[model samples]
Target: MHAERLYPILLLLGSNIFMTFAWYGHLKYKSSPLMIAIAVSWGIALFEYCLQVPANRLGSAVYSAPQLKGMQEVITLLVFAGFSAWYLGEPLKWNHWAGFGLIVVAAWLIFLD
Candidate 1:
């Protein structure tokens, strides 16, 4: 695809990476104070929003709001799945994979005219 379409995808990917860390990275640091974790997560989330907002804005030129949101959800799940397994040491069960597959199908349906 053209840069117009590709750029937003890249931005969203980057944003989701940051978001996954922000949301779940602290699980490994349970010994840290809750206040400290919250503060750090908020800082990381600020960067996520920075990228996410621009991604949606640029993507809006080529995609509808619902389409953008659908894409974001898919990206989030994919990123979280990997992050959960690799970084969080959480193994996804068969049912989790099936649920994720269903969500992927739902995302595909959102693109249908």
Candidate 2:
């Protein structure tokens, strides 16, 4: 693929990393106060939005709105799968893999000419 498109994909991947951590990283710290979790998550999410906004703006040059969203969803799931297993020690069942496979197919369809 062209570098123009690749940049947005890379940016999206980075943003998703921050996003996954923000949303789920605190689960391990259940004893932490709710306010602390919320505050830290919000701080992390600030970085997510920083990259996400630029990713969408740059991606818009090469992709439609639906395509951009599809890319985001696909990246999110992939990132979450790794985060869930490694960070949370929660591996997905076969059914979850099957569901995510279908989503991958959907993203493929969305990107098709």
List clash counts for every candidate, in order: 0, 0
Summing lDDT over every window of 10 consecutive residues in candidate 1, give the lowest-scoring window: 64-73
Candidate 2 stretches greater than 4 Å from native? none
Error of 2 at 86 (Å): 0.5
lDDT of 1 by residue, 18-52 (tens): 99999999999999999999999999999999999
lDDT of 2 by residue, 1-113 (tens): 99889999999999999999999999999999999999999999999999999999999999999999999999999999999999999999999999999998998899888
Range of the 10 consecutive residues with the lowest summed lDDT in candidate 2: 104-113
Residue pairs with colliding backbones in model 1 are none
Best by TM-score: 1
TM-score of each: 0.97, 0.96
How many clashes (backbone atoms < 3 Å, residues ≥3 apart in a chain or on different chains) does model 2 have? 0
User: Pairing residues by index, what is the TM-score of model 2?
Assistant: 0.96
